[model samples]
Target chain A: MDHKILQTARELIEEAGYPALTVDQVAVRAGVGKAAIYRRYASKAEMAFAATMHGQWPPPLTDAGSLYEDLLALARAFHVRMATPTARQVAPALISELAGNPDLDAQFQNTFLAAEHAALAEIIERAVGRGELAGPIDPTIAHLLLLGSLAAGLYIINLTVDDTMITELATAAAAGIAALADRHHSGNPQGATQPQ
Target chain B: MDHKILQTARELIEEAGYPALTVDQVAVRAGVGKAAIYRRYASKAEMAFAATMHGQWPPPLTDAGSLYEDLLALARAFHVRMATPTARQVAPALISELAGNPDLDAQFQNTFLAAEHAALAEIIERAVGRGELAGPIDPTIAHLLLLGSLAAGLYIINLTVDDTMITELATAAAAGIAALADRHHSGNPQGATQPQ
Candidate 1:
């Protein structure tokens, strides 16, 4: 039923990309009637959204005791998540498709991007709580550095996102955050506010 | 006439996306015959690639005296290059299309990615020559951090790639590279190798 349709949709996206995914094709592939899919999703976009939601989402962030460990753990988890065969195929398609479609983009943000942002924000917040990170850390920028570096390595440079790459990225991100915190503290002592 | 056809192709991509940019439509829009376009480009991909290459690429890297200034300059330049209306539309489409099309991917690498990598590598080389960076700085990683962070900020988070964002990214990247260099130097005194 629902699980079978979703799995079939994921496979379709992996094999032929997002554009090739059609409601009819998904129904045919899943051996279900079109009416069944239409009952669950109104359109191809909805089907893709539902399929992505049903697919692998990054796991909940765990407290790794230290900021370095937390970032490393997060990076490693994200690397593994993005390294999946489905993710490798689906993510680029989604990113491109979402860029043009605002409604889909909003749905993606609400469903996926926001959760990822929150996970990274939590890691930064915990570091601040432990007094390991200084006040006024921009979690968005930190997340961007961490995940963006990984994305570039994986997508742009065509590098294998292995343990070594993840470790290096996490370490560099930690150092970058510390440096920014120090600069902010020294430059704007009174403006520095603790992470909420 | 060639320029006009290329411009029309770019407009087609911007308006209707890459898939919609067909030789027939481009000929109609550019007020040129199909044979005229065919004389230059064998297919739509070739036309799109030519148009992109004919359009703005990021400027060559310039020495800005200090590593921080050099990186900041490079980041700002890249930000401007990516912030173009055409770039905003075409880049994501190209990325998605290129992932599946190995011939286009190879052309993209040979035409664009390799040049960018070399430019960043040259910048890092100059920094090492001046003793600004330690031995064994990985330019590929450095380029990934800088451009990847920029791409995430621009594309993913939907953040405006403004001056403040560029400055912050460049600063963080500079710090990250410096930290990595120090760690590399300390941990692998004998094993440290220059950027390949």
Candidate 2:
């Protein structure tokens, strides 16, 4: 029953858009009563966010050994999730909506952004443990390089981050992180790559 | 006259939002006739895009000698433009609106994206000529790294891309580009930094 409502919501979002979606329309199409939807979701925005992002939460973190492979895995997972009709069409509009509403933005940061940040922290930690990264690079900055670039490529230019693009992006990001860590430790550019 | 109209439009967008902004309100505020606005802009979207982006268009690119300095200059310029009240508030919603409209998206690509791309191409060419890069890296990819990440950082998290952030990002991006070029030249990772 819950699956049916969520799927119906996804269909409506794909057909129309995040802005056009409403509780009434969702209730009607899902063949469920308004009470049913309200019981499941607090508001139209919540419903829309869930329908677009339900199964894709926590961002599919991987235990891949190296920073490059780990970032690649995360990037690929992000691409797969974002390439969905629902996510691609809905996310930009949803994010735009977030600009006006502080409550919604907080909700988003708490739910989606928090999870993704946690996943990234774990990846960075694993990389440090393996000596692949000299120490922890800023997770927020790291997140920007890896996932932020992928999101921008898709949202801004409609350019899909393909395997080649992903490989290049992940490699560059890993290299960038290494360089940053090196700079932080020694303060000299020349000593960036030497053994600690 | 055009400046007054654009400023009024920007103020309306900042106060209410992209959707709530009307040509009527802009005219009243600017103390100009409706005909005056229509003469300058085709529609409300155009006016808003222009008002939010009038002087910032063609993205201030610089030839600061090396790729790292050049990229840092570009990054700082982008930060200044996007950090404005109007651009920060309006851009996300405007981009969201672009999803449903093809002609508007094309206009955006032609007006903003194209100029930015051309500027980046010039920068990449300079890097190649100076032997800072082995060969030209993908301009689209480079744009994503330098500008896209900055956009995401601001739009998503409201985190301003400060000097510290820009410095770290520029360093990483430069390293990333070099690593990519090296990989392209020779398959071996060790050969990435050797004199060409």
**Candidate number achieving the greatest TM-score relative to the actual structure:** 2
lDDT of 1 by residue, A30-126 (tens): 9999999988765675677567642456587779887778888888877776765555555666656666777777776776677777877888888
What DockQ, between 0 and 1, does each candidate earn? 0.38, 0.50
Residue pair clashes in candidate 1: none
Candidate 1: true contacts recovered, fraction: 0.47
Q: Over the stretch B1-196, how does candidate 1's per-residue lDDT look in tens digits?
A: 9899998998888787665678999999899999999887766766876786434565766788866678888888777767665566556666666656677677667767777777778877787787877755777678777888887666655566678777677777777777677768766532221111
Candidate achieving the largest DockQ: 2
Candidate 2 DockQ category?
medium
Model 2 chain B scores worst on lDDT over the 10 consecutive residues at: B187-196
Per-model CA lDDT versus the true structure = 0.71, 0.77
Task: After the best TM-score superposition of candidate 1, give how far the Cα of residue A28 lies from its true spot, in angstroms.
Answer: 3.6
How far out, in Å, is residue B177 in model 2? Answer: 1.3
lDDT of 2 by residue, B1-196 (tens): 9889988887888788777888999999999999989887767867887887745666666678888888888888877777776677777767676666777778777778887787788888998898877788788888888787888887766666678998888888888887887777656754342222
Model 2 clashes, total count: 0
For model 2, name the residue pairs that clash: none
